[model samples]
Target: MSIPQFDWEACINLMLQAMQGAQLGLLRLLSWLHLARDIDGQPAWPFALRLSGEVLLIDHNVVRALVSALGCLVAALLLLALAVAWRRRRWLLLGLAVALVLLAPWPDQALLTTAATPTSFHTSPERFSAAGIVRGEQLYRQQCIACHGADGRGNTPLGLSLEVAPPNLSSGLLWRRFDGDLYWSLRHGKGGMPAFEASTSPADRWALLDYLKANAAGVGVTDTGSWPRPVALPDMALDCRASTVTRLDQWQGQRIRLVIGGTAPLPSEDPRLQSVLLGGQASGAVGAIACASHEATALRAIAILTGVPEERLAGTELLADRDGWLRARNSSGQWSQQDMLCRSPLASGSPVAQVAQVGGSGLDQLIAAMDEEPVRFIKGGFVH
Candidate 1:
């Protein structure tokens, strides 16, 4: 009689079918376990990974299914080898196979594949302007307010449902992150939060950054995202050249120009800035104040006033109108509208000097564009 052929292919097929059936059985058990745990009738599972723009549900059922599939496949192969070894009475082969299967290192390794995929995305160029901040504020109200609260304090009822509470955007912890980092976090949310990349536009993302910066600086930005009337200029003395404690109110009736001192010539020293001032003087309605304060303090003050980032404050100057309303802001030294007020390119390592203009205008065009309304300052104008 011919011995029945031991078909290796049929044995392998039977092992695979057994593995699949075991995996399905394990999955159903997991589902039953989940249903048993839902005493309050909320979502049965409390964990999720936020993907590109959607929540990747990772409830007990999913985790159990994956674990069961991997465990079943490994067990099936090991059992097949052990069966063959037992049939041949090879004890050493069975023992070695069991040892190797027990020592497999799948659980100890980090989730390297998952980590590599999420952080590969990029964000758009940052936009740092007052308008951007206002628009961002509006977007925040519509989308983020439900979780982060109207003040960005993350104290809302919905926020309490998360395993990890959402971070307060206005806190100092977020200060270390730049606009790019902020954009990335917003586009690809972590932990329990959902991603906003698909729901929010690139422009709106930049605006949200501007708004966050402004909010962090303690600006009392309203929840609706409207530009608050220019806060009252604090009574900080301008400390100009040849003038002591020069208050901002001194420039109230005429356009006030505050040029933060830098290597670029002081408004009083540079012929270009002077010529622009002369042009504004010709208009009979120009007031310029040169602030020689420390660069760090000046930057903070400007950030509070206009919501512009400090790095973006390079070059150019600040122009506020007669009613103490901010009219136009320049990013770099080049002023297109003013013919003679252009900032001369500074030689490398040029020394900075403090100079002040109690009354002048290097930006007549900007001054003219100022709102022609009576000055109205918000209460508690600026923080000390």
Candidate 2:
């Protein structure tokens, strides 16, 4: 008798397909439950819903309520099934109970406790506007600089004298916390920290947060080569010739190339991006918008965001996405896409190369890459 040959390749292919399908289904389930975490261990909520023509962002609270409702519905169904089984027979009830015990979702106790803990319902009223950040910087210097230091590293002598040394505001820990939680801490004293509520107004507190976040972002990028959180480009008043636009935020829906300081004449502006010049003689020059008012404040804010000295920012170039999220920085007087600070989530987890090896100009490649894998931001934080 001849033995039939086993189709090993076909079996392997079938197994692979099944595994892939299972993985995709699990991911969908996690996303729906709002339990998915990105590479950065931050919540990866799929909040954007594309409607007929525009994209609508669902509120986080609404999404949470929906998930809770779904969970409650599932529990009710299970209870109904168990009740029906109990009425049928005592043995059936026992069997159903056992099945449920085995199949029920048993989450970690720690995670359950965390979920049960009440979070502050309040959110920052300040939208992190450039004006808010400038006010924040002033407040920070006046109130926080004593303990937190000018750089926010909490390296000052007063910080060391505390029972619990002040935390480094420039660290990623600041981004990990909710803005409301931070607000509460500022309004009411936390361990070793004094209450600011007596001295600063509510608006001032929010502005302080903006400055800390902006400072932390710059320090983070300098230390780690990427933003710790999704940072909005600090909005500032702009002076544009032959254009009605008056502020940086008005350029939303278009990419911005911000040139801080360079001796060279501004390069021909790419149609894909709007060029904004700062700290140069080309104020009224062609192909770029210039900052006429608030130049000093704008320059200082940019310095905080880049972790570069005010003087050194002259030759720096920053790239902001269409959504106004700062994405990259190039210190070299020349433009190079390889200097991207916030890499695409789709990119291989490899360090950015020092030299450009891809085809076409660096700017073109960067724009294409950005469009292909746009940054995903959730609740003021970044999801890698």
Candidate 3:
């Protein structure tokens, strides 16, 4: 039987499609694997998901298929080139070329970057108002209130049996925790909960947080807005600290305890020389003090130092608190609800924000605004 003519684009497309199909099948297969908790000492979430990807990658049958496709391509090319040089008939030469090209070995290029399909979910949602409270409430009512409850209580009949208790969104402990941590939970979805990362856009998630913060049923970071008469609220202690010590290895992970009233270093002993631990808290002895939230602080520092532009900072928060949670965030200044909804003390009441705004995405925009002069953020922590 005559071999088919060499079609480069078609062959490439087919190989790419096969690789993508195999990968997608592999992901679907993994979704079936009911992994028990705690495979290694580490958390089950990262281990199982990552391991699934690794395992799917090593399937020999899939590997063989990829190899076979490559081999065919090489063989076809060689035969086609030879036939063309010899002035052979178009159909015959092309067929022989394809047959020969089929002998080369390589993996499909399409498989390199796996595209995760967006997840779809359906639920009755709550709606909120413009200043952003009701809007957040509405979003929670739709996405979370079913499990957490309209009251922010965890007595949902459907969620009772779950090993992981649905957190009280209005609880003081929950709201006080970093917003990023809350955001992460919503995005990744712990335990049996499905991941809402792809489903719930970041802006909507924040709005939900705002509602949880505002109507937290008398919970959340104790809003000391109004104090008792005759006794004023303790002033927010000036946190301005200048440390020149560079070798961060000494006190990285330890939670450097700071007395809320006075930022004093405990005399009896502070831990020394720790790596930048995930949850940055100095146990009894060892400790270091970094930004409260990496998202709020880290990216800003990087931008100040690197001269990255404001617009370039991905909506992802960079500065992390001692617990590695995003207490504050340097979200994308582009079209974020916060610009219209919330105010930042750091932003100095201005909506236009930037991280590395000098050199990064905002370069063009900032450049146009300069009045025959340029400014540096060095004076403002890392920015100034």
The residue-level lDDT of candidate 2 at 81 comes to 75
lDDT of 2 at 257: 86
Clash pairs, model 1 backbone: 277-361, 288-360, 316-332, 316-333
Candidate 1 lDDT over residue span 16-135, tens digit each: 345435533544465577732331121222223211110101133333343545675577577667778587756666666566566544333221122222222222343244455566
- Alpha-carbon TM-score of each model against the true structure: 0.32, 0.67, 0.26
Model 1 Cα shift for residue 266 (angstroms)? 19
Report lDDT (Cα) of residue 273, candidate 3.
13
For model 3 the local lDDT of residue 146 reads 68
Better of 1 and 3 by lDDT: 1
> lDDT for each of the candidates?
0.44, 0.64, 0.37
Task: Report the C-alpha lDDT of model 3 over 1-384, residue by residue, as the tens digit.
Answer: 999765433333344445435644554454557432321121122221211112222354544655576678766777677777877476787876665555445444523322121221111132222224445666777777767776566779866777887876555544233333455556677765677867777567656655564445222222322110011010111121253333222233332222211123322222321112111232211333332222222322322221233345333222212321112223342322232211212222122344324444332322222211222111101111
Q: What does candidate 2 score on TM?
A: 0.67
lDDT of 2 at 56: 11
Candidate 2 achieves a global lDDT of 0.64
Candidate 3 matches the true fold with a TM-score of 0.26
Kindly indicate the candidate among 2 and 3 with the higher TM-score: 2
